[model samples]
Target: MAAIHRLERTQNIPIDLEQAWNFFSRPGNLEKITPAYMRFRITSPPVARMYAGEVITYFIRPLLGIPLAWMTEITHVQEGRYFVDEQKKGPYALWHHQHHFEAVPGGIKMTDIVHYQLPLGFLGTLAGKLFVNRQLEDIFAYRREAIEQLFGSMN
Candidate 1:
């Protein structure tokens, strides 16, 4: 059966909301946080700040060192609070991601909610169970470490 999957991740960054937003809102900073193996490279032109309706393109080698082109649009933005990116063209049948940030006790709390669907129906479900799910987890796990390395740990 075809299915939709959601991946939610939350992390606390020991930085102010403006600092966190500045870092995350920049399209160029994506490569910095992403794992090198993914080879995430932005093809979009640089912008002073992220804005809604901005379409960004990238080349990523997610598996086997093979490169793939992905395009996504910044569909929503609420300044330092939240933003949503939806895939316009990519490997997935559907991909929508939302990022939210809020001030917490000692830092800013960042949360990511990703809703995606695979393309090949039941085969996709099997693949998600076998690989996709774990890969997503690994990517986020890497992100957590990278963020902490970039900015001191909150713990």
Candidate 2:
């Protein structure tokens, strides 16, 4: 069995909680923050807002432009506070992600916690150690820049 890996990131958005929540809650908005090189594209019908039990499907070229089909269901939602999305079909053995928003002194604090496990047991472990972690970091870095451009700087 592969070991479960965790990744968490938090950023202060220089925007009101409602605006932050509204932008992030829409499934289609993912493409705006994602790196263009990854070719992230949503296959599911466009949604204005997300709710529990919403199933989202996408095609992503995570590596070498090789397209992969990924599906995730919004398993939990608490309106503007938080939401959880769980993988139903994807490359990973498991994927559960939580998005949380809190109104802070300056702006909104957005947090992302992702728990994921790769497939193929030991081979998966090796791949994760060699590249997957770095890939995830790069993706998030891109997201931070994209979001900052959209919502202005937090500092």
Candidate 3:
């Protein structure tokens, strides 16, 4: 069995909790923060609001420009507090993403926690050490910078 990996990122944005939640809650806005190289796109039909049990479809070229179709479901939602999305069909053997929001002193404290596992047993484990980890890091790093650009850097 391959091991599951967890990635956590927390960033304070100079925006109110409502604004932060509104932005992150919208699926269309995801492309803005994602790296251009990944070519992330939401194939799902447009929806104004997110709700539990909503399904979203998308595609991306995470590695080597190989396009992959991905589908995820909004499994849990707590309004302005948090929301969780899990992979229904994607590259990962498992993908569980949680987005959390909190009202901080100056703005919003937003955090993302992802639990994912690669497939292919031993090969997957090896792949994680070789490529997947770096890819994820680079993606998130781009997201962080992009968020800073959109919302202004935190103190």
Candidate 4:
């Protein structure tokens, strides 16, 4: 079995907690922050808000323009605080992502914590070391820039 890997990132957005929560809590807003090359799209019908046990599906061409159907279930939610999503079916052997929101000095602090395990045992470890980690890094970098664009830099 491959070891589980973790990635965490935190950023401040110049927005009120309610605004941040309102935007992030809506599942449809995801594609706006995702990179275009990934070709991310939600397959599930529009949801006004996300709640525990909600299952969301998406079609993403994250790697070679080959579409992959990914499904995630919202496992936990605390209004205006945080929410957790876990992969029900996806590329990773395991994927648990948590989005945290907290009110800070001037705006809201958003933190993302992701835990994932690749498949294929030793090969997965090798792949992680070789390029998977870098790919993840790039994805997060794009997300950072996209968020900055949407709300302007933290002021």
Candidate 5:
């Protein structure tokens, strides 16, 4: 089995923890914040609120023209603080992401920690070396910029 690969990023947003959490935790708001290139869509039934056990499905093309269907379940939650989601079905052999928010000097500090493992054994490692890793980085970079635009200056 391949070892889990982890990626973490932190950003300070100019808003209180409650405001940040309220915005980030909403389900419908995902499409507003995600990059356009990814074509992210929620396939699960629409819900008025999100909580642990809620399943979210998305369709994305991680590579050139290859549409991948992914699904994850909200596995844990702590109101206005943190939440964890684990992949039920996705490109990865395993995927678990934890989102945390904490009160900071001017506003709030948000952190994203993703732990995942690719499939296809050694081939997955080679793929990551070739392009997946860079693509993933770019995707997140776009997300960060989008969030900055949405919430205002973090600097």
Candidate 6:
């Protein structure tokens, strides 16, 4: 089965779209917001900025004591407004994520949309029921808190 999840967060950063984009589009900034438990890293050669077709690799623990190597490619880019990354190889059967940003009255509104499917058919279903779904939510929640701390409040 296919599942699509979305999370939207608006931040009152007192910055314009360009400023927001510059900070977010840099490759290394990911380490600032990502949870330390994931041990997220960019395996690709260091680049000053991000653009479409760039590939990033990371090491994560998806389950109890199971380390997974994940790689994703930036498939779409629209400068400051949005970007998309799809999984090239990972624990998921499929993963496509879109990160969008728009200038709002106070600051910038950001949204994350993720569409994914797990492998192993029935086993995947069981995993989702038992743990994966909750784990995903927790991960995103951590991201949300981190972003707020980094950029300030949306309200």
Candidate with the greatest TM-score versus the true structure: 3
lDDT by residue for model 1 (47-109), tens: 898999999999999989999999999999999999999999988999999999999999999
Off by over 4 Å in 5: none
Q: Global lDDT of each model?
A: 0.93, 0.93, 0.94, 0.92, 0.86, 0.79
List the candidate 6 regions with Cα displacement exceeding 4 Å: 1-14
Candidate 5 vs candidate 6, lDDT winner? 5
TM-score for all models, in order of appearance: 0.97, 0.97, 0.98, 0.96, 0.94, 0.89
lDDT of 6 by residue, 17-134 (tens): 9988988887677888777777777777877778889998877765665678989999999988999999999988888888888888888887788877878888887887788878
Ranking by lDDT: 3, 1, 2, 4, 5, 6
Candidate 3 — which residues are off by over 4 angstroms? none
| TM-score, predicted candidate 4 vs. hidden true structure | 0.96
lDDT (tens digit, per residue) of candidate 2 on 58-114: 999999999999999999999999999999999899999999999998899999999
What number of backbone clashes does candidate 2 have, counting pairs of residues 3 or more apart or in separate chains?
Answer: 0
Candidate 4 vs candidate 6, TM-score winner: 4
| Residue pairs with backbone overlap in model 5 | none
| Candidate 3 lDDT by residue in tens digits, 1-155 | 89999999999999998899889999999999999988999999978889999999999998899999999999999999999999999999999999999998889899999999999999999999999988898899999999999989876
lDDT, candidate 5, 10-63, per-residue tens: 988999987888888887778776778777878788777669999998888767
Q: How displaced is residue 82 in candidate 1, in Å? A: 0.4
